[model samples]
Target: MSSRSNISQYQGLLERIVLCFLSTGPACFFLLINGILMFSLRSKPVFRYTCRYILLYNLLVADTAQLIVTQVLFLLAVGRVKITYAVCGTITTMANLTAGISPLTLVIMTLERYVAVCYPLRHASIVNIKNTVVAIIAAWAVSTLNNVTRNLFLIEYPYEKFGKVLMKDYCTNIGWIPDSLCDDYDRAYNAVVFVSASITVISSYTGVVIAAKAASTDKASALKARKTLLLHLVQLFLSLAYTLYYPLLSALAKTVQRIVFVWVQNVIYVLFIVLPRCLTSLIYGLRDQTVRPVLLHYLFCRWKLSVEPATC
Candidate 1:
């Protein structure tokens, strides 16, 4: 659908190889850290039963799935490997599902923090093991529903146009669907999801700030909650900004030299798409006191963390 890659075809073979190598280095490293953090979350009973930790585990799982799917798509685009609609649909659907789930999970995490800060006395009862589990399930269920609806619209498209056998170009979500409704649905869904998530985070942050001022409140805990919410807001913003991936490149291609356009596209992928997925693990792994030592121990390859020369 995008004859936009006419400039990309002019890129040198050796140059594409180097670009892939450079991007893969950071992608692999982020995936490694994410794996360690995930293992740390399950290696002990503390994480398994705690409400916030359980929520963290769910969020990490979504982010990891998101990272893997996007990376696979990126590799395909880089190699210019065109495939059948069946393959592209499966991969892009997974990408679309994960992309939506991450923001929703982040919203859940934000609300959990808000409860802890603003309603400390009732936090445990309101956000217990059962409810947190239910929240995570609802996030995934909603995202799956969205994916199914979009695919229905996709199936409704008059495939006689492209013949439905093989995609004419490298796969991206917007490229496969030629319908105006699909584009409009995409814009509307993305706007609603991101905007709602952003508002939720901001409201939670505001609640934490207000609670911090009460004489009955614990200022320390509320302060920490504020900072954490801020980080989540930053992450969400980066995710929302990435919706411009195709249009941004298309505009640049028309104005810049081909070589410069290709290089800028590569850098933008790393900055927006690749980097935000890594932030969730880094932020919570290092920021939370309870998870830090265990995360670091596994991150550096040790089974047990030691402080007394033998054990903590």
Candidate 2:
């Protein structure tokens, strides 16, 4: 491409930078409020004891991590400076690992809800605190193994004339291999993660719907089932965006076109990852009436005003 073409290609980068800044400001604001809410409710008995609450809390934590990672890396990318390999490797590994695991954790939570609504008799025994903790541990383990294995194979030194540097900045899976092997591996990984989540979601929803049909007379159960389905649907769409963006990245290689791609990717991350987190607190507020009273009580009590709660 000519110099003019290069300039045109990178034109989108400026627009993206503006959008990222706009999105980041709100994301940070949401994170601040969400963090306060999470901490305030941390000790509450309902949040402490419920399996669903634990899952939701984990999701929020993971999303918060995503927000932090993306914002910091994004700033660096925009500045266009050199990044050492060590920092890049670790950040890349952690970001991808955590982000990938979160959706799978959501899948597990969906299954748990399915069992609760579809097979109430087994819900208590199947999804108690102990089992819930074990499930979370298993999820972390699986996600760690996937990232570590993939990174280990991909990250190695290039001898005099033997191998070449496999990846570029920030643990991103970039290589100069003219072969399709790496692509195949990526496709396989995507397939496994996507297929697993899809199957779990389909089965869980099918079970819920079937159970809802049979128990239509129970209005409360039906309503709970519908709410659960809606939440899962939102999560599925967000995750699908996650699964799709990576494959389409290459098509945006023109310098100017990449600007739009970069911003779109960041915006998508906010919508899919960060919004779910902010929505968690909101969802709790809307779905559980008890949360509102407790939250309001925490915010304001009948005690006489003193120096100020900020000091305390």
Candidate 3:
């Protein structure tokens, strides 16, 4: 009996170590890729001056931060490392706050594309450097407001009763949910953001298609703009998956065996967390003609650079 118990413990520990590697491996890769893309964005004058590239840079910054926070939470959960309610709350709040920025940035990017396609004559004046800066600031400001609202709701919890208390479960955005009121607030906020953003992107896509058919608006450019808008919608779906993956895995845990739950969680984590976080890098890093050569130059440690800038 003693020998059997020892073997079981060893197997479980080994399994956890492998799981951590499986999950963190891709996250680290994406981190490296995003870092390169960020550097590439700052490497050229055009990237710095263009409205859309500036927004892509903004989006990458938020996604990278969120990815780091997420990896920390994953490590804590897998290693069974205990954390206090205060620590958990702070970390989870940061995660939630950063997650909100992606969709907002996407909405802004979609609108920018709409303007460039439908109203090319005024695109320059309408989406200038000053306006782009303000849009990015407004995105962060809104996310911060949402963060503030979450903290306010959290203050009502009776943390004083249990001073310096460690949370029972692993630290997560959903770990120590304070009250139903906060949950309701979160749901409503998410719903409004998601719906409003989706409608904006989809509507803009429709308008761009109509404009392409009616006017002589650079057929190739219009086609690419429509494709980019569609990619934005896909990105929205991936971002929403990040928000809901934890609750979903938790609910599934109740129905499955422990071994099954662990495997499913790992798979879903890589898909939801790893895949989406790096998506921005892949989209603009490789897709944009102007960015590709520069991004590749950075990715290869600036060893070679010969390609001319092309249309994004």
| Most accurate candidate by TM-score | 3
Q: Count backbone overlaps in model 2.
A: 4
- Estimated TM-score per prediction? 0.90, 0.76, 0.94
TM-score of 3: 0.94
Q: Rank all candidate structures by their lDDT, best first, as comma-separated numbers.
A: 3, 1, 2
Candidate 1 yields a Cα-based lDDT of 0.83
Steric clashes per prediction: 0, 4, 0
Native-to-model Cα distance after best TM-score fit, residue 140 in candidate 3, in Å: 0.9
Compare candidates 2 and 3 on TM-score and give the better one: 3
lDDT of each residue in 254-301, candidate 3, tens digit only: 999999898889898999988998999998889988788888888888
lDDT of 1 by residue, 1-312 (tens): 355576555546678787788778898999999999999888877788788888888878888888898888888887879987778888889988888877888899899999989998888789888898899999999999988888877676665644457888888887666667877888898899988998999999999999999999999999999999999898888766667777787789799997788789889888877888888898999988888999989878887664221110
Candidate 3 Cα outliers beyond 4 Å, as residue runs: 159-163, 304-312
Evaluate all candidate structures by whole-model CA lDDT and list the values in order: 0.83, 0.64, 0.88
**lDDT (Cα, tens digit) per residue for candidate 2, span 1-312:** 599888976875676567667767878887775675565456466777778777767776776676677566656655554465556666766767767767777887888878778767777888888988888888888878877666555445443332333334433335222235556765688788778787887777777777777844355775676677667667756654545544445555454366466666666556655665566556654465555555444445533322111100
| Clashing residue pairs found in predicted model 1 | none
List of clashing residue pairs for candidate 2: 9-255, 9-256, 10-255, 10-256
Candidate 1 at 71: error in angstroms?
1.1
